[model samples]
Target: MAAQAKRIIEDAVVRKDAKVGDKLLDKAFALAFKGLVYAQIWEDPVVDMEGLEIGPDTRLMCIASGSCNALSYLTAGPAQVTAVDLNRAHVALGQLKITAIRHLPNYERFHRFFAHADHKENAQVYRTMIAPHLDAESRKYWEKRDIRGRRRISYFTRGLYRKGLLGNFIGLAHLFAKLYKIDLSKVLEAETLEEQREVFERELAPVFDKKFVRWLTSQPASLFGLGIPPAQFEHLAGDERMAEVLRRRLEKLACDFEIKDNYFAWQAFARGYDRSESAPLPPYLQRANWETMRERVDRIDVVNANMVHWIGDQAEASLDRFVLLDAQDWMNNAQLDDLWGRITRASRPGARVLFRTAAEPSLLPGCLDDAILSKWRYLEEQSADLTRRDRSSIYGGVHLYELA
Candidate 1:
């Protein structure tokens, strides 16, 4: 089974006859993604849910990253949500979260486990409550020890938010911020948007101008922690300095929304959610939605497979909504067609597909088959509006496409 999973990824590396540089870069990205990557998702679920407009009859399909967004989607009362990922660690995390939601005693306890994310009791909760409910695969994955000889689950008790690839990347950024005498956590304390922008311009924005920061951002490897493949890096860095792009995105994160309620900003800057106001919590972790989420948690089915491969296996027109979170940025033209082909086959009438890109324009025009592309109406205006409102502010564009 593991061999098959590995091959599934191996098979995804198209351009087999490409130049040495491309091949080497592809190999590096595949290796980086093969292991545990995102401990927490980077996308903005508020923007995603708004764009999706999920309802009781919505059958959503998505790439499950850290399981945060999938759980968030449940609040909209979707009839079903199928989350597929190439990473087994990601699938395990999704499954563990679902299990925790179903079995945890209350919303506070749930928050303590994920939001607080470093309580020793979290490991205890896992042993007594969460572990039993996890499948054999997830159980084994969490039980596995790290290089420090601690169980991977111990992250819950030891700052879970600071452990994964993305987490460590943010940690590195914080270290750089400290070097420049800028405290990132200050953004979290700002009471309003103007204050947030003032703090960012005063403290955070200057850090990007440092030579060390600029040099680091210029390297493709520096962004691997953000789960950005080298191919995507090319798009983000095109005709502009990578540091400049990063600074603009950071400005958006720090200034575009009120820091008190934008949990994405809080997480990026402070490494955790706003503990004082439960309203800032992810939808699944919020008090009011916990019971409903708990009831609806069973609707999600986690799968360890490539998106196209998995979607191809489902019945024709089985899915109603597709959340392809920036995965298309990594694909070549042929691969995009393959993915969209399966999507067309698997999508029901009126299905809406939402995806983000590392670059501004949608990836479909020159890549996807025109006939297949014709089946969907690109929601260009709505996507642009949502892209500006995305509090996460890490992506270049957010796109929505509805089946025509």
Candidate 2:
């Protein structure tokens, strides 16, 4: 099944390279990520935490996932930001966020544009207000028709949250429940919060405990779609029952954060974050002083490039913050060397580099010899506390590092 999924992806994406921009392997990487895990369903608050060092002089680089985090970063006064992504869909989404924040008449329209993403009026609003600002490539990407022959932005029209990888996976799980004589759709239809909690506990909880289901989860290959590589699978199970580990993670994803406050958790369970006039905070959800954040926004420049390729393109010691989002797992040592080389060059004194991975520690240790990596201060221990508190604690760790 993994092999088949890979082939399907290669034909549809890697070979087509339909979403490839800036031609960094990240298009390839994005496809790979999509094949293994869901992309762009919700913003991970951890990424926002990793990227946010908001101040007048701060500049940051982060993955453009649906653009929510990008604007959330805008709330912080940073000199400039360079949002990058290989997925054209995500780029279009990010471009839309940038456009909406700058052009939407006020917070109300902006709220409607996103929080209530399914409104049919959004397409018109997007065309009139947000679409014009998008770069040609990104514009075309979102405007293009999907397999269902619907405009891509139509994904926002209904099942707004059901459009991303995680959404699709949950959808599949619901379908799977049908095979087991479970009516997941009915469970999902619980409209009230009390009903949702009751249904999740009573109806959905049994599937995880079935002997057959638990047996299937024992294999690493089964969860590749969730982007659990073999190494990550080991870390996740960690001497506990696979069911228990998932329970712990899901509990973290669902329960650890406040219901109204945690956007990541809301997106995971409720599809969209919130459906009200005033919405919940997004991952990079800060805008403390708009004047300062606006000035900071002006100072940033966004480019399309990957770490290794772009590092090769730059002279040394240039960047203050490097945001890597679990791409290292897809790379080899040479790639790591090149990427770190670029990090080494692009980094300024006191620069802090942040990234997340499937495992509990930095992907840098074995790939980057102690000789070279030693120069960079590992904030692993320092970040451990924050990692414990991350919204997507489904994975193992959130790591922070500072360049010496």
Candidate 3:
């Protein structure tokens, strides 16, 4: 068992070898992203907020991925936001944005900071304008010299935020498709609705029909790059009928979307998006919302630790909402219980939690049901709406809960 276990849990012990780790990147499906943040665009959280019937005074806590939606919450003008994550890299990503918005003279500068992130000049600007705002840890992470011996700040010299973890995984999946002789990237560049229709009809549809794609779709390990753990894969889609459900979901992703309006579709087809002032923007990107953003920016807080430890620091009934992004898939029962228990303890009378999953079903009901899990009401209809509208066509499921 010990030797078998060694093979099972070696991911953490192994240092990243681009040569070897390249093969294993998507195996973990860990969530990592940076710019043009699109987590759940179509879900329109504001609409969901309306459904939650939360008040203007509501203070919420959520995982700050790409910080887009978390910053989007500021548009609702929530009183406070406490963002938590175990990934120092992600926390670094969030802190970087919050600091940039406040310090970078204007939106163009701001855009440049992230848009042309692969540049060196951005580092100098960061060291001068943004670095002072960051904590020592983040400053260290960004300031640490890159392989070029140029500081990591050099990455921003041109201010383009490149393909991050999620972006990279999406790219890797594309390469895998190519290695396997499939091409999803070309689908994104379809110039017109007619072109897109043709591509989907020809190239995209075959991925679902092919034997290898079908086999890969059926395997739990293959979904890791999308952040589905083996347990979560089993819990969500591990059933005997999983292949059918997965096929249905993938089909929906390929065909159930309108290329023009669907941002998730765009991300799937193109690794990135075409940004414009009038474009369908995310909550965090809307310029008019910045004043409200500025006022509430100070209200947002972050913890450079795992959620369990962070939740421990909150007092009973101290929080109003929670956003645990697909991270629950990575946790076991005891960890889940500790987290939910703390969340339960810290929640107010009508607190709500927003979460996503790699599979259709949620990870909570088994442990957090009505009798034992009676403290929360799963907002199923609202969750469905969010899932349907989610601009980041990444996850298979979305869920919402109101504390009982």
Best by TM-score: 1
What tens digits encode model 1's per-residue C-alpha lDDT throughout 1-404?
66776667666743476788877877776777766788778888888998898889989999998888998899898999999998888998999898898898888888889889889888789999889888999999899987689889998899988888888888988887777788777888788888888898898877778888899899888898888877889888889999999989889888988876688887888887777864477777788888898899889999998888888898998889999999898788888989999989998989899999988899899889998999999999999998998877899999999999
Which tens-of-lDDT digit does each residue in 169-254 have in candidate 3? Answer: 56776776677576776665665656766766676565666677668777756654454555566556655445555545545655
- lDDT for each residue of candidate 2 in 1-404, tens digit (9 for 90 to 100): 33443443333223232234423343343354542133343336545454445566766666555555555565555666777654445555666666566676665566566665788888888888878776786677678777689887776667556766556766666566777776544433455556645665776677788887898788765665565444455556768778766755665654455555566655655556555534455633333333333344454444544435555565566566766766565555665676677777777788877666665666788887566688788876666866777766666666778877
The RMSD of every model to the true structure, in order and in angstroms, is 1.5, 6.5, 6.3
Top candidate (lDDT): 1
Q: Quote the lDDT for 206 in model 2.
A: 73
**Candidate 1 global CA lDDT score:** 0.86
Q: What is the TM-score of each candidate against the true structure?
A: 0.96, 0.78, 0.78
Summed over model 1, clashes come to: 0
Residue-pair clashes per candidate, as listed?
A: 0, 13, 27
Cα RMSD (Å) between model 3 and the true structure?
6.3
- lDDT on C-alpha atoms for all candidate structures: 0.86, 0.60, 0.62
lDDT of 3: 0.62
After superposing candidate 2 on the true structure, give the runs of residues whose Cα lies further than 4 Å from its correct spot.
Answer: 1-52, 174-206, 215-244, 276-279, 283-302
